[model samples]
Target: MNRNVILTCAVTGAGDTTGKNPNVPVTPRQIADSCIEAARAGASVAHIHVRDPETGGISHSTDHFREVMERVREADTDIVMNITAGGGGDWTPDSEDPTRGGPGTDIQTPAERHEPVGELLPELCTLDCGSLNFSDMVYINTAEWLREHARLVQQAGVKPELECFDLGHVWFARQLQQEGLIDGDPLYQLCLGIPWGAEADTETMLAMRNKLPDNADWAAFGIGRHQMPMVAQAMLLGGHARVGLEDNLMLKKGVMATNGQLVEKAGGIIENLGGRVMTPAETRERLKLRDPSTGKIVGGEA
Candidate 1:
């Protein structure tokens, strides 16, 4: 069991979850507030995504991103920001013309995905290693696209959190490491319980965990009901944990949960299992994230 665990709270996801869960932050102000609340409750990192304020739909607008970043920075909190570079990959085939994209399809080139990260220069950003079926829609991140995205992330001097939804994704992430695309010790987030991807179970998590690089700093999160259980499982297996409204919406079966409540609960679980949640500074040190102002990796064992 790992004594020190870094808990990242994914504040609001790029999902159609706001209507499902009233607490899912829609506007930039709400997202920034939720991020701060999670940080105060023991989250070491805040994984962020923006949405259209009027529609609450996922948006790739840099203006929205800037607003959230400004609010978070103005607050002067200790949370390490990790923005999503995983946007603009949704592709649903049009029934009328199968070759063309469908109504829900929103695909962007690799450079588009890297725009927010490159412009804002967050401490960390995600690099989705492969494409997979996201429910009925296909989230496309081909090898070529990934290579371009990885290179841009490396250029921006931001660490990429290799997000693996399945075993194949994990394999490709290792390949990226072999090719010397990622810098510093590799960081990963094993995304389980998403439909048509990896299942949320001990056997699955363990199998995927075994495939990661020896020096990787990895965390795992299960969507919906599997969220809290996977948190415990991840900690027991010597991996880190993630929580918040992005992966789950409730403290229990019928209860509506906020991001702060979820972080507090996850922290309680960590302490119960004889582990402690690492602070934001500690996680920054472990990931070797560049300081937001200095453009230099913070102090650590390295």
Candidate 2:
């Protein structure tokens, strides 16, 4: 098992989850506050996604991103900022015509999807490795799109965390690395327990983790009820952990959880297991992330 672990708290997600839990942050101020709380609660990174404040819908507005970044960056506490570059891929077949995209469709060109990450130049941004049957919709990220997206992220000098939803995604991620599309050692996030994705279980995680490159830095999370259990499982297997409302809405059976609460709970699990929850500084060094303030890539391999 890894003695030192980095915990990431995904504050909000591009889902219809805002109505499911009252604690899900919608406004920029709220999202920033939640991220700060997670950092204070021992999260090394805050994985962020913005939503339309009034409608609680997923948004790709750079204005929303700007506000959230300004607040989080100017905050007193230190937390590695990770923005979603995986937006605008949600696709559903139109009811009237199956060939056409439906009302929920939010597809963006690779250039459009990379706009926020390109402008903000965050320490980290998501690089979804492949598409998946995300619930009833297909989150489309073609190989061509991913390769193009990787080039853009590399140009910005930002780290791209390969978000693998299944075994094939891991394969594609490795291919990206082999092609030198992703700079440095590839960082990975094994997204588990989403409907039609990899199962949130030990065997499945191990299978995915086994495919990672030798120098890979990886973290894993389970959605909904398996959130906490997967934390222990990942830690026991020497991998990092991720938690927050993006993947889970409840603290217990019927209790809604705040972002800080989830981070706190995950932190407790790590400490109780005699493991160290890494600080943001350590996380940067471990992940070889460039400092936004100093604009230099710290020298290390996680």
Candidate 3:
């Protein structure tokens, strides 16, 4: 069992979850406040994804990202900022003309997807390692696209959290490592319980965990009801944990939860399992994360 775990709270995802849960932050102020609250509640890292305030839909606006980052930094908190570079991958074919992109299709080039991370220079950013059938929509991130994205991320001096949705994603992530695309020891987030990707079970988690590089700093999260259970399971299997409104909305069966509440609950679970949640400083040291200001990999507490 891992005695120390890094707990990351994905404050506001690029999902249509705002209407589902009242606490899902939409505005930049709200998202930044949630991140601060999660940090205070024992989340070492805050994974952020901005949304259009007016529509409550996922947005790729750099201004929205900037405002959120500004607010979080102004709060004087120490949570490691992990911005999402996984946007603009949704593809839903048009009903009228199946040949072209439909109403739900939003695809961007590698440079476009890397724009926010490149400009903002956060400590860490996510790189969805492969594509998958997300529900009825197809999330596209082809091999050539991933290679280009990986190069862009490497140039920016930000650590890319290789988000593996399935076993093949893990395999491709390893290939990226082999090709010298990823830098440092490599950080992996084994995203589980997302429909048609990887299941939220011990066998599946273990299988993915076994496939990771030995030097990798990895974490896992399960969506919906599988969230908390995966927190415990990840800790037991010697990996870090992740939780927030992004992956789950309920504190329990019928109770809607805020991001801070979810982080507190995950921290409690980790502590209860004879493990302690690592602070942002500890996580930075462990992951060899780049400093937000200097863009240099740091060793000790900042």
Candidate 4:
């Protein structure tokens, strides 16, 4: 184990979980409040994905992101803000046309998907490595599109957390690193146990972790019931962990949970494994993020 493990809390995802858990925050204020609560519970980073307020579905509107960022920034919280740049990639095939997009399709250009990151300029944002059959639909992130997104994120001076769902995606991330598209020590987030992605198990996590660049800063997460188990696994394997209402809503079987409860549980797991939980400031330094105002790391440090 690395001894110092970072815990990230994903407050609310853009998934269709509104009916499953009533506590998932929809509005910006509610989302910011949940992020604050998670930070209080020992999460050094907050992985955020905004949603459509009225419809309670996923949204990629820059305004929605702006609202959430404004609220979180104005608060006194010290959690590192990690906004999602992985949205606007869903593609549902047309039932009638078959070759074209259907009613639920939301495919977009790389620039469109990254507009919020360019505008908000957060310390960190995600870059999904490749497209996959995400459940019944495809998450369309072609290599060209990914390269474009990576270039834009690097140009904007925001760190990209390469989100790898499977082994092949990890390979692609490495390709990007080799091409010099992704600078500095890369950051990766291993996403496990989605419908068509990698399974949530020690073997799968280890395989992906082994493929990462030696100098990379990485974290792993598992969905639903596998969430907490992955937390312990990541820490024991010398990696960071992520958890929150976005990934798992149940604290126990048949019991719903809040974001704070999830963060607290993950923190407990890290502490029990003889790992020190990182604060937001520590994570920022480790990831090499410059303070927005000074154009240097906060505190003249890092």
Residue pairs clashing in model 4 are: none
Clashes of 4: 0
Residue-pair clashes per prediction, in order, are 0, 0, 0, 0
Residue-level lDDT tens digits of model 1 in 10-37: 9999888998889999999999999999
Worst 10 residues of 2 by lDDT: 293-302
lDDT of each: 0.92, 0.93, 0.93, 0.90
Candidate 4: tens digits of C-alpha lDDT, residues 1-302? 87798889999998888899998999888899998999888899988999888988888989988998888888887788899999989999899998999977887798998999999999899999988888899999989999999999989888899999999999999999999999789999999999899999999999999999999999999999999999999988889999998899899999899999999998988888888889988887788886655667553453
RMSD of 3: 1.5
lDDT score, residue 99, model 2? 98
Residue pairs in collision within model 3: none
Off by over 4 Å in 1: 300-302
Off by over 4 Å in 4: 298-302
State how far residue 15 of model 2 sits from its true place (Å): 1.1
- Between candidates 2 and 4, the one scoring higher on lDDT is 2
RMSD of 4: 1.5
Worst 10 residues of 1 by lDDT: 293-302
